[model samples]
Target: MNTHFSLFRLPETFELDNQILEQRYRTLAAQFHPDKFAAASGFEQKQAVMMTATLNEAHRVLRDVIERAAYLLKLNNIDADSPEHTHFEPEFLMQQMAWRETLMDAKLENNAAALTELAQTINQAQTELHRNLQVAFSENHLEKAAELVRQGRFLQKLQQEIHAV
Candidate 1:
């Protein structure tokens, strides 16, 4: 698989300038959009369609902090999705459980304020994790980076659940 960084002509780092990524995506999308190839031959049109798909996938992956970190780990020979890599610190696991229970309690009580506070707490942790991920990637700490990405995934799912509530 082509690395999303290479596809977007970006450096392989956890910290990315989102504006640049978006601009590159727009440029690539405009270049490969099917309408631009409508007058071309069948093979060319098909190629454009494939390029468009690739561009979209690249944009989607690179635009998200968690996916981008996971991608960086994969590029560095770490499988973030592997079972071994899924192990989080015990404290983190306990914290996640506490957050989940709090969320449940908030929902059961129909307390929007509590839910909002929990969401904010999760958001703050996510932001900090993103910063830590940037440092980990910069220092070539692949294992640490992978762990951070796993934590990020958990937080993201929790955030989604919060939204659902």
Candidate 2:
């Protein structure tokens, strides 16, 4: 484990046990929450805010299955930063391109139904990607997990585009 986990003081124990995580999260939140420093010195309050922000970020990452898996992979010395680690299945990439085309077509035609369909498709992909992420993480398949993260990023981007319409 690198200093990244230490930066947030997040547990480095690969324990996915939710009970332990929840307790740790709550303890950190309580300790760093800005409200708890309402009467502290200015510097203390600033430090509390910074700590709280870090704690909140950690909570967000830990609470999300995909993010948690990605973090764990990083801890395991996996080169998740590069797509070179895994060859993304070409068929899936082509499918994603088709979906992107659909979204573009929908936007150009101002078709509400098409936008809705695209949203549904992206949402389904997100679900599948999350499931894959869990499996990849549990099996220590870092390359596969990284590919899923990339796919998830595109799906999320598409989701935002749909909403912007």
Candidate 3:
């Protein structure tokens, strides 16, 4: 029942780095996927099902940019929960808000050109932010990376909302 990342240890053959994490995910999934246990006894099948779910959840949280940032902060004993001031500049937030508002208004007006531009802008921002995140993580700047992740998560949500509209 422990949700702590430390409790999610890799197999001895695996490691905590990104590549090993993915490898472990695949290995566990191959063994624990429901399809792989279909002919097992009821108890064995249930265990496989639970293991599969846990493996998927672990992979999801570990692989995601935002979640990985938060996890890294926790590992370093930083207060990553301070979303208000972790990594983003005010100007960046302001620009994001303006873009979101534009997207909202454009959706209402059914402006194809506006939508296209907005999409491109968002994509470009994402690319830059991803690079920033990589640099921050590599340099052990969890605070900075956390900020980029926060912005990315917000932009992703905004993109989904716009698409839904």
List clash counts for every candidate, in order: 0, 0, 0
Candidate 2's displacement at residue 93, Å, is 1.9
Quality of model 1 by C-alpha lDDT: 0.91
2 or 3, greater by lDDT: 2
Worst 10 residues of 1 by lDDT: 79-88
* Segments in model 1 whose C-alpha atoms lie over 4 Å from true places: none
* lDDT of candidate 3 at residue 159, scale 0 to 100: 68
| Root-mean-square deviation (CA) per prediction | 1.3, 3.5, 4.4
lDDT digits (tens) for residues 3-81 of candidate 3: 4354356431111477867776777688678988788999999998888888787788787766766666665676556
Best-performing candidate as measured by lDDT: 1
Estimate the lDDT of model 3.
0.72
Across 17-105, the per-residue lDDT of candidate 2 in tens digits comes to 56666787788788888999999999999999988787778777776655666677777676565657555679878987898899889
Model 2 TM-score, all chains together? 0.77
Q: Could you give candidate 1's per-residue lDDT for residues 14-109 as a string of tens digits?
A: 888999999999998998999999999999999999999989888888899999988778887888889876677999999999999999999999
TM-score winner between 1 and 3, please give it.
1
TM-score of 1: 0.95
* TM-score per model over all chains: 0.95, 0.77, 0.74
Query: Could you tell me how far off, in angstroms, the CA of residue 4 lies in candidate 1 after the best superposition?
Result: 1.8
In model 3, residue pairs whose N, Cα or C atoms come closer than 3 Å (at least 3 residues apart or on different chains), thus clashing, are none
